[model samples]
Target: MGAAESTGTEREPLLGPSQAEATVQPVTNSGRVYGRRWLVLTLFSMLAFLQGMVWNTWGPIQNSAKQAFGFSSTDIAILVIWGPVGFIPWLLFMWLMDKKGLRASLLLTVFFMVLGSALRSVPLTNLQLRRWLIHGGQLLNGLAGPTLMSAGPLLSTTWFAPDQRATATAVASLVGYLGAACSFLIGPLAVPAPNDTQIVNSNIHWDTEQIRNRIQFVLYAELGMIAVLFAVVLLYFPSRPPVPPSVAAASQRLSYRSSICRLLSNMRFLMIALAYSVPTGVLAGWSGVLDMILTPVRVSQVDAGWIGFWSIVGGCVFGVAMARFADYIRGMLKLIAVLMLAGASLAATWFTLTCLTRLTHLPSTKATLYTSCILLGIFINSSIPIFFELFIETVYPVPEGITCGVVTFLSNLFTGLLLFFLTFYITAKDRDGKKQDNAALTRGLAKQM
Candidate 1:
């Protein structure tokens, strides 16, 4: 059967296959098209948000977790590796998206996400067992990364009209960043600044009990939120519309093997992937080691988390706005990406300089850092949907699942590798004022606090 027949949508030949050629596009008998697509976008965006939260869960609270478990920075570093670790499953999930469609893929994704959180929240007297369970849980949750990350392009292409595709993709993708933003806010609030009320022979001491309780609270809270979202997804989210949303979607999809091969050979696609990969990977690496990197300057987890929150807010707002603007002015996709990326680079550079030097002690440092973070967030996030839409447009006829999935996989792989190695370079001053390994670095951080 042709694409139209398979999707239960009628089509008529138009300018080209690249252009949606449907004369009577998918609509209800009442002539209203995609009455539920917006709802669908909301559901998928929520999933994307949860995925981001789970991925960055350890970052904001790394110090508390370290003090609680006596964990090394390397152990915490591995948390970021979960994304790369899922690459094998990522390939399988993409195949599922192609062969079985979004419904089956979403089911598999949600299952692991919930299971992972539950396992992580599991209480065990044996610290080693508890640690391993947390690792196992993160691993399971990692499997959902590609699915949520790719949902923007997959759902946008499958549900929206050509005119609205980029904006939808942007909104969905931006929510994931919003999740990360919330993680930063939630992290510090969950584990508030250590109380410095105690004075023992001219020494200020921390309130450790409060930190432990906060960590426990954050874990249970995360599990509760995941449970609620999981129930909603199981009951309401559809795999796809009964009728195809666009002529491009009504057409048969390319084989997974062929899609991969085509992507591998496409220099433009690789370039686009590379352009996105570098800044995003650096950002990921920075977020993972944020506490460690800022340790010397005495930046608290709450401060780090708040910075992240502001950045994400900037990213989400600009990301959606930029995507809508790109849709309005259709042909300048490459130009938009370039300008935004440059802005991100500048912001990251400025933020780095401010933190590295004692410039943060200067009166204007906080304002500078916040502004730079917001700009960095805006530039990096705003460019993502542009890249997603460009990738699909450049590689016409290939499924959005494959196009977006490959890019997500590559970016994640790069991020994981970058973060893994970046952990090595992070050093801290011990109680005796000597530079030491990450394990000692945690102790150093504790002493400083």
Candidate 2:
């Protein structure tokens, strides 16, 4: 279908006189009432939580997977690529969602998630087969990624008034972080304890196999729950709200391309996207290697799990708070750009400090590391809500499903591809350096002996 034709549908009323009046309603002594919209927001948040949970499940267990599969950092990097690889197909899905409807798109997302999760959970006899299946599952997961990403912002735009849009979007963004937090906090419990002989120095222990099984089980359970949510969504998610006859025709004739172009062409959008790109890449890469990063710092696997958890916590807190503030000020785009810049700065600082501390072998910097982590979480994640809010406010009265899909598709696609190349280069350099260092050390020791 043509873009314009695809976007054309029975239009819902953008705003009634009463609703329009309420848009500028003064804060009474009782304060603003967010009644049913809260319910809609809550559901969208749950969707975010589920998406985050699924995506993050791999990070805390990366070390365990490496040991179990005899995989190098490069191999693990490939695994990381699998997650965002799904972003490529998301554009088509977005188009389809726009052409079809929200319910159709949501159903498709659930299907992909279910299929991917089920595939990932299946045991394979050979290592190659397992890798193939896992990566395939990741691709399927990516298919659903855009749907969930779009759904939250779309819901926010449709259900919320202008003043509430930022806060609603922010709360939606927080849900995913909350999901990530839950995964990290629960990962340790899911894995079985190592045998006594496996313990090193009475503190360190590793159980690679058990961790994999635990992860598989979690994915299976998540898939089941997602299937349930799909049913609920199919039944309950509205296509459009009731509209007055006079304005309905105008709303129905709105063009998806016009809305998308408006958002994509905005200078503010580009700035926010660029500013967020680096930090998003860093976070994505860091999460994939989180276990390895924490190992040398005396953080055990169990303790390291808390890193993702706390990062999510920080993200959730900041996402909600900043979103609400932005809503109040109608500064969603500005807030997003500021948050992205702040996140990038914090990440760079943390990276520098981490390198220095490691090279100098300075006194344990646990507190410093922890502080950096919290800041990283808050700053890095705050952009999500802000971006969502900006998208909704800027693309007013447009078919939300299509607009959301396009924005998410572009953002994820760019960010994902950028990280893929960055990951390859960084891992390759680190590997070469390690190999050279080992060889030099060996030669020096032999000469001394």
Candidate 3:
């Protein structure tokens, strides 16, 4: 078969001759099987898992850095921007994925990840240097994030049959979340007990700088593993299976602009984007602020780290199960919307309770807060695989690279903007309270005068 073309406005049948034959032939009589494809899927899942594992470790460790550097809430907030900043390079690389192919892109991403992680271990003399190195590391990792996030769906679509695509994608995506969980879980264990309160209070002190060095060393090792996988992908990853001429020819092709225009013009994309963007934005903000928010509630740093770890665990389990259920019921869009709405509601409840708890000076409602957060994690993450599948199905048979790039770009862009705005809003609220307090003080002095 010639190179597969990009998808277009009109829907075309995805069933190649093999699929059609399978429908007609007895299941036992079918000559073709995809045993090798399963192997590829497993490899891709591991790559995704490794990528996520590395990326999420920073969240649990952020408080330690904050204490080390004496960073305020605002400074910490600025740190979160590194992810979106890193995304710029990530998106640029993704645009090239179609022309470059999966193996090349995956290797480049892993290289960046390794480089970033290694650089993060370098000791800096001052806060400025520390900020630069840390954020710069994050920037590189962000570039890798999109590649890792999209790799699974693309692999599943290319390798798996239509009937099995959703399940395959779910499993791969679930692995990524599990990797994130593992990162948080591992980070606390990796660090040593510190002498001063900085590490103890923040729950992030690398007992010795050696811990950071060890992480970098492990990242370098993982880079070698990625290189091995890249070779495997090149040798084994199927571009497209052999197919009949007619079916191959009929696969609709369109220019990139045309495909994008169709996607943009679709009302469904807008609705899904809006619904999906909210929880995504919330999660980004929550991940950044979770430690800070817990401070007032007097939750220990270790507990906070565990909370983050468990949140990812809940998200991974719930997201996978829900994605599978959506496939089973054939209600992918509905399931995504419902899950997102539920997440938003849970988040709203959590935020409201948090504010009340703060104002009332009540005992830290850690259990309630953590429970809500766990549910929030699950529901928020549930939308991702669903959204990914919907984008592919809705824009039937597009070159997986282009389709994934466009969808991820939109989701990341909006989510980034929302996070920025939300940060601004929260900052403004704090400033307003300070202003009110000052005004009351001035009024009292004026009355005495």
Candidate 4:
């Protein structure tokens, strides 16, 4: 719960010039074995994937979730925001990791995720009660978010050789993104498509029975997956290997507060963190509202889901390649991050304007939207692993988990603020327009979809 300070007298060397070089450079021969680190990476990566699965579950199915519970766009948006809102828990859990080590923190994460999944799936007739239960479930799962997000870099540092850390982290990150992509594909696949006539009549709004049935099907599958993973993690995963896999990981860890202070004082770290915060927050917030943004364009939920699917696919392919290249080159991390962010920003801006202008019917415009989504995914998501690796590189000797936790916490705060305003602004605008053309828009919207 509380962090203990490492006094100067008791503290290990703060990873100065000599120590930094020794830890970060490759020491092992090309043929050297990596021991059980690979197995550990696999286990943590599964956790990352499962966390991704639950985090975006409602997003791909946002429309169904909204209809099933009769929630407004604003109300459903709150569910997505809960994950970032768990920033407080993020700090506590990261501290837990630093104080208690990986196994305790990881077990804690699994417990919250499983318990949350079970609670969320509780079938109840009272709509409001069911909504609250699901909200509560989401908040619990949110507590696990920081742990999973930060764990890849930390795990890589702990369990990989210097040359292997970037690729290992990239692979772990890839699976998590893969889990998210599957959610987009899986959410709609689990729910039968609305009848053509029903879609034309009511804008793809399924009957409550249909919505509930689809949601139940997905929830049960999610629960089953969680149960299996829980067993796997508990049985085979260790707190750590008896031996340290890398010199960097074997180095002394700074106290939590001290690490925070160090990062705060570092101008390069602060600058990069600020720049990195924007795309990460924007992309995540935009993902949550994708269905709503596409509503006026009449993009069917299935089509919108496919857009997400392809976007994440792009992220996986490019993300791994970029990370591995960074590992090989071992420089230009900042320049690479900047170029990726620039590309993503351009793609995102182009897509935003097209969607807002209601240009979906234009063949060229639709193609543009899909292309931009994938490009945005590739650029933004690929940059994530690079920026994280750069963060550790810049602030050597600071434990990967703590620095990553700090970065995630701050970026998520920005994300929450962006979502808060975006939700209100869009919701208010939509509400006002609906008041004037309620009947005509309803019919037209249905036909458009």
lDDT of 2 by residue, 1-449 (tens): 10111121222233444653443332232122334556556655676677667776666666666565555666666666665677777657767766776567767777787787777778775877877787777677766677677666655545554455556666765676688678777765675434432346676555776656776677678888877876777677654334322222224535656766776777765665455555665675576557656766666666677776787588778778877776555433664667566765866587556747658664546566666776777777777776655554455565666655666555565556755775678688888999999999999999999
For residues 203-286, what per-residue lDDT tens digits would candidate 4 score against the true structure? 545577987888988888888888788888788777664445444456677899998889899999888888777777777777
lDDT, candidate 2, at 61: 63
Q: Against the unseen true structure, what C-alpha lDDT does each candidate score?
A: 0.75, 0.62, 0.61, 0.76
Query: Given candidate 3, what's the lDDT at residue 13?
Result: 33
Candidates arranged by lDDT, highest first: 4, 1, 2, 3
Candidate 3 per-residue C-alpha lDDT over 1-449 given as tens digits, one digit per residue, 9 for 90 to 100: 11122223112333545543442321221123345567767877887777666556555555555445555556656555555555665446655566666667777776777677666556666667876786676667677767776666666655554445666777876687677667666655654323342434465545445544554454465456656755666566554334311332235555555666776787876677666655665575466556666655566556666777787778777777766666556644665657577766867577566657657664446677777777777777766777767766666555555666665555566556755775687589789989999999999999999
Candidate that beats the other on TM-score, 3 or 4, i.e. the better one:
4
Each prediction's number of clashing residue pairs? 0, 0, 1, 0
**TM-score versus the correct structure, for each prediction:** 0.85, 0.78, 0.75, 0.86
Write model 1 residue lDDT over 336-449, tens digit each, in one string: 888998888788878777766655454336578678877888788778888888888788777888888888888887888786666564423232245346568899899999
Q: How many backbone clashes does candidate 3 have?
A: 1
For model 2 the TM-score comes to 0.78
Which regions of candidate 2 deviate over 4 angstroms? Answer: 1-40, 192-200, 203-209, 243-254, 296-298, 331-340, 358-364, 393-407, 422-449
Overall local distance difference test of candidate 4: 0.76
Task: Candidate 1: list runs displaced more than 4 Å.
Answer: 1-32, 195-209, 358-364, 426-449
Please estimate how well model 1 matches the true structure, expressed as its whole-model Cα lDDT.
0.75
List runs of model 4 lying over 4 Å from the truth: 1-27, 30-34, 193-206, 356-364, 430-449
